[model samples]
Target chain A: SAVISQKPSRDICQRGTSLTIQCQVDSQVTMMFWYRQQPGQSLTLIATANQGSEATYESGFVIDKFPISRPNLTFSTLTVSNMSPEDSSIYLCSAPLWGTDTQYFGPGTRLTVL
Target chain B: QKEVEQDPGPLSVPEGAIVSLNCTYSNSAFQYFMWYRQYSRKGPELLMYTYSSGNKEDGRFTAQVDKSSKYISLFIRDSQPSDSATYLCAMSAMTSYDKVIFGPGTSLSVIP
Candidate 1:
């Protein structure tokens, strides 16, 4: 299992403002992903942060809204752009360790958009 | 229909009781099954990982997967008050590491 950490354990912001969340893995991982979770709800995949390439986003999510940067294998950042009350959710990052079927997650950044 | 379905339970049980959590899926293609536990204000922590069918036991936790019925379960023996948390069921098709899907999760509280 990899130790994953995210910055700004939580934050509160006004609607239309943007916030960026960072994910850092203790070890190098080949796959890094960003996820969003509403309070008392399931997690939704936002995008796959590819190393040195463009991020792959899931349906219902767009790059312009959740731009991701993967400069290396151990670090990635997800920026929630032009936030809305609907965007109030816990942002998480996860990575599957090499040669393993399990994915480990960061503590998460809880964003509250008022 | 949702790919995966789980009872959003706030099931309360006394400490030391056996707790059963379950999930059913519509997709038979899902090969990797996982159970995750999330405490308040924390991320989902992987508690059990099973591939295909059969039961895997570790300490007080036992994970059972029944591919024939498209159902999976997690049983916690001697449940503790610290076990109070939300449990999520997740799976992936074939060997795709990124094709994972998650259930809404069940909230369990083991009271002392």
Candidate 2:
């Protein structure tokens, strides 16, 4: 099992403003994943952040909207730019256990755009 | 139709009762199935995972997958109030490192 932590557990931001969420893992990991969960909705994959390289985003999500930075194996950041009410959702980060398929998630950052 | 379908149940059951949760998928390519539990204001925790088909048991939890039916289930024995949470069903065609699709999740309340 891996322990992950995210900053700004909950935040209220005005529309058009941007917010960056940080994820830190207790142990080094090669890949970090970002997800979003809207109200009463299932989790949606946003992007995959790989250490020392660019993040690979899923369809319907673009780099200009959700830019990710994975500087090292233990840390990554995601910035939600030009936020809108529709972007208000719980953002979560997760990483798989080393040498295993089991994944562990951090306490998600709840973002509410007003 | 959605790739993954769940009842989105707000199921309530008494303590010590048996609890059953299920999910159905349209993608036959999915070979990995997982159940995740998420408490209020918390991130999801992986409860059980099964590869391909058959049943996998861990403690009081049992996970079953039927590939032919494209269905999976999670059964909890002797439910407790601590078990109150949203249960999500997830699947992947390849590995966990790949994109995994998730269900709408079922909300469960185990009343003591």
Candidate 3:
């Protein structure tokens, strides 16, 4: 099992502002992912953070809006640019343990854009 | 249809009652199944995980998977008020890059 920590557990931001959330893992992991959970909705995959490379984003999400960075195996960050009320959601970072199907999640960063 | 389907139930039950939560999927290739518990304003915590089809028990929680029916369930015995939260079911295919499809969580409230 792996432990993950995310910064800015909850934040309230104004519209058009940007907020960057950070995630750190206790151990080196091969893969890391970013997810968004809107109120009362299921989680949507945002991107896969690869160390030393560009992030692979899922459909309907782009780098310019939700940029990601994986500087190393244990740390990554997601920046929500030009935020809006629609972007009010809980963003979570997850890491899958090597050779396993389970993914451990961080405490999550909740952003509220007003 | 979405790959996974689950009843987003705000199911309420009295303490010590048995609570059942379930999900269904359309992907036949999903070989791994898992259950996650999320408290209000908290990230999801892994409750149980199962590969292939069968039942796995841990303490008061039991997870059952029926691959043939494409159904999975999490049963909580002796439910407690602290157990109130949303339960999410997730699954993935082997060839996938550990990218799992999550179901809309079922909100369960074990009322005292």
Candidate topping DockQ: 2
Q: Which tens-of-lDDT digit does each residue in B8-47 have in candidate 3?
A: 7889999999999999999899998999999988888889
Ranking by lDDT: 2, 1, 3
Q: Which CAPRI quality tier does the interface of model 1 achieve?
A: medium
**In model 1, which regions exceed 4 Å deviation?**
none
Report the lDDT tens digits of candidate 2 across residue range A1-114. 568999999999999999999999999999899999999898999999999889999999999999999999999999999999999999999999687887788999999999
| Candidate 1: fraction of native contacts reproduced | 0.66
C-alpha lDDT (0 to 100) for residue B8 of candidate 1: 79
What TM-score does model 1 achieve against the real structure? 0.97
TM-scores for all candidates? 0.97, 0.98, 0.95
Docking category of candidate 2: high
Is 2 or 3 the stronger prediction by lDDT? 2
The local lDDT score (0 to 100) that residue B51 gets in candidate 3 is 89
Candidate 1 residue A69 C-alpha distance from true site, Å: 0.5
Query: Interface root-mean-square deviation for each candidate?
Result: 1.5, 1.0, 2.3
DockQ of each: 0.69, 0.83, 0.54
Question: What interface-residue Cα RMSD does candidate 2 give after superposition?
Answer: 1.0
User: How close is each model in CA RMSD to the real structure?
Assistant: 1.2, 0.9, 1.6
